[model samples]
Target: MRAVVIEQPGTVSVQDVPDPIPGPGDLVVAVRGAGICGTDIHLLDGELPYDRYPIVPGHEFYGEVVDVAGDIDRARIGRLVTVDPNMPCGACAECRRGRANLCERYEALGVTTDGAAAELVRVPAGLAYDLPADVSDVGAVLTEPLACAIHGFDGLPRRPQDRYLVYGAGTMGLMMGLLAADMTSEPVTVIEPNPSRRALAESFGMRAVSSPEEVDPDERWESVIDCTGVVEAIEDGLGRVRRGGVFQCFGVTETDAMVKLRPFDIYRNEITVIGSMAVHNSFDRAHRLAQVWGDEKLAPLVTHGYALDDYAEAIRTFRDGAGLKIAIRPGGLA
Candidate 1:
């Protein structure tokens, strides 16, 4: 099997590796498509902590069941499936409370264990889900990411006429804007410094602003979402949200990063400051939207796709341009 392994922090290589075989309760999935995530970038940058080196680095992925055992449905073979990525200990306090995303003993597939960046991967059968018939393999791979955005919005009670602003124009930011648009008559405003991403947002009928500093003070927003996870961006967004409105921090910043907030502002305005960590009961929501809308709504976001051998070029494409989503068809579907 061929795989891209993270030999160490800030290093990676595509090489031949042993094929994964299913364990008692595991199933082998033939890799099909994998979506690169911001977490991957964080892993490459030595930002996010993870297990020791020589591990396959991937999690947002889709594939077909190649082998299964142990009371599992044999019919899953050859069916396209997307991974849940996060495996929680069901007995944990968080899991018992139905908040598996925040499970105390959480293990992430690509970070804590070897992931689906190769020709095949073996995972616990319970975490695999069949891709809806109407969804493309590429689109199905985006479920994890969309689920994160869904969880971010879930923190607040949304209203049909609530004016919202999404700060950032990356894949997560744009997805937030699009999803908010679907729920409200109030326009969704996107704040992105990148001209290309701003232009891309414009094509989708959303308002785009280059910076929060440029937004008129008179402009009021009921909800503001900070998707960049950058400290500066999060701080700037706070000042724009209306009194009694909600402000969501959707991204995690560096450990050392700090944002100075005025407690008086929150006290006087009755503002709600919330943080969304990860997907919780959002896979089904994203899957339903993917099934109903198909690829058209998200096609604009997938700016480039590459083959397994072109992983370097794929990273360059994402780093150098304002492309929303860069994908890899590990099995040549791209």
Candidate 2:
């Protein structure tokens, strides 16, 4: 099998590797489509922890089941599916509380283990979700990220006519905007400096602004989500939310980044500041969204596609501040 391995920091290579085989309660998937995520960039930059060097790095992907372990039905074989990349220990306190996403013993695919940036990958059967017939391979590949966004929204209290603002028009921000649009009529604004990204956000019928300066200081958002993971965006977004409004930090920032906020501001405003990590109890919801939203909704996010062999180029395209979502088709897309 051909796999792209990030041997270490500042290193990536496509090399022949042994095909992944299913373990107990596991399934082997023939990789179809995988997408680059911001976390991947962090991993590459040595910001995120992962297994030792030479790991295949991709978690958001869709594939056909090539094989399965245990007594699972044969019907599952050859079925198109997407996976919940969070592997949780059932015995963990978090899992016992039905919060598997925050499992005390949790290992993420592509992060703790080898991922789908290859010809084949093995994952837990329990983590796999069947893809709807109407869902395209690309959309299926995006279910993971969408699930994360959906979970974040699910955790937040959203009002029907609440004015909302999203910081960062990247994959996570755009998904947040799309989801928020379906739930609220209040103008959903996206703040991003990238012209291409802002244009893309506008094309989705979202109010896109190049900076916070364009947004009226008096215009207070009912809710604000910072997906940029930058200190500046976080501080600025906090100031944009209305009194008593909720501010959700959905992006994972660098460990060293910090922002100084007035504690009195939070106290006086009675604002609620929350951090949303990965998806929990939202993978199925995400799959359902992917199925119903169809290509019409998912189409807006996919701005580039690359062959698996061109892994470096794909990573560069994503890191270049260009596309909203870049797909990595193992065999390349037509």
Candidate 3:
């Protein structure tokens, strides 16, 4: 099988590797469509603490079940499915509390183990969800990220008519805006510096701005989310949250990243600041969202595609911020 292998931090290669074999209760999927996200870049640069080097690195993907372990149902073979790549150690206290995403010994397909940036990959059967007929292949590739965003809202306390302000208009920020619009029954406001991304956001009928200054100076949002993972964006977003409003951080930042917040402001404004991580019992909901908002609503986010052999090109495109979402088709770039 051909795969994208990260030999180590700053070292990557496309090479022939042994075909992944399913373990007990596992399924072998022939990779169909995979997405190259920020996490993949982090894994390549050795930025994530969870990344284990010399690993196949693709977490967001959907495929057809080619084979299954003896304990699994044979009926699952040939089914189109997307997986929740998060593999939590079920015995951990966090897992026992049903907060598996924060498991002490957290493992995932692309981070700690080999992932689907190959002709085939193996994953737990229980984590796989069948893609609905209404969901397009491109939309299926978005399920993992969408699930993570859905989990963001799950951690949030929503109020009817709450206005949302998202700090970025990239893939995650766009998804957050869509979800916020649905929940708040208001046009989600977005701040993006990139003209292309701002155009994409507006094409989705979102109210976008180049800077927060463009919005009414007297106005603040009830809900503010920082999806850029940049210290500047976080700091700016915190200041824009209305009094008694909630600020959600849904982006990933480096270990050493820090921001200064006025403790007095938080106390006097009654502001609530929260952090949201990966998918937490939201995979099924994400699959359902694909059914409801699949090709028409979400697939537009995909603006680029690449062959597995062109993983490096995909990474370059990502780092350049060339598109909204870049898809890796294991079968072919087309």
Candidate of highest TM-score: 3
Using all chains and alpha carbons, the TM-scores for the candidates as numbered come to 0.95, 0.96, 0.97
lDDT of 1 by residue, 1-334 (tens): 8888888877887899988878788889988778887777777677776656777878888788999978888988988888888888889898999889888887887877888777788899988878865556546868788888888888876888899998888889888888898888766899899999999888878899898777897787889999888888888888888999999988778778889999999999999999898778887787667655557777777777788878877777777754778777778853
lDDT of 3 by residue, 109-187 (tens): 9889999899899999998999865558767999999999999988767778999999999899999988888886688
* Candidate 1's TM-score: 0.95
Candidate 2 lDDT, 81-175, residue by residue in tens: 99988888878888998888888876888877899988899999988999866667657978999999998998678778888899998888999
Model 1, position 93, has a per-residue lDDT of 92
Which candidate model has the greater TM-score, 2 or 3?
Answer: 3
Off by over 4 Å in 3: none
Candidate order, lDDT descending:
3, 2, 1
Task: Give the best candidate by lDDT.
Answer: 3
User: What's the count of clashing pairs in each model shown?
Assistant: 0, 0, 0
Q: RMSD to native for every prediction?
A: 1.6, 1.5, 1.2
Which 10-residue span in candidate 1 carries the lowest summed lDDT?
132-141
Report the error of model 3 at residue 312, Å: 0.9
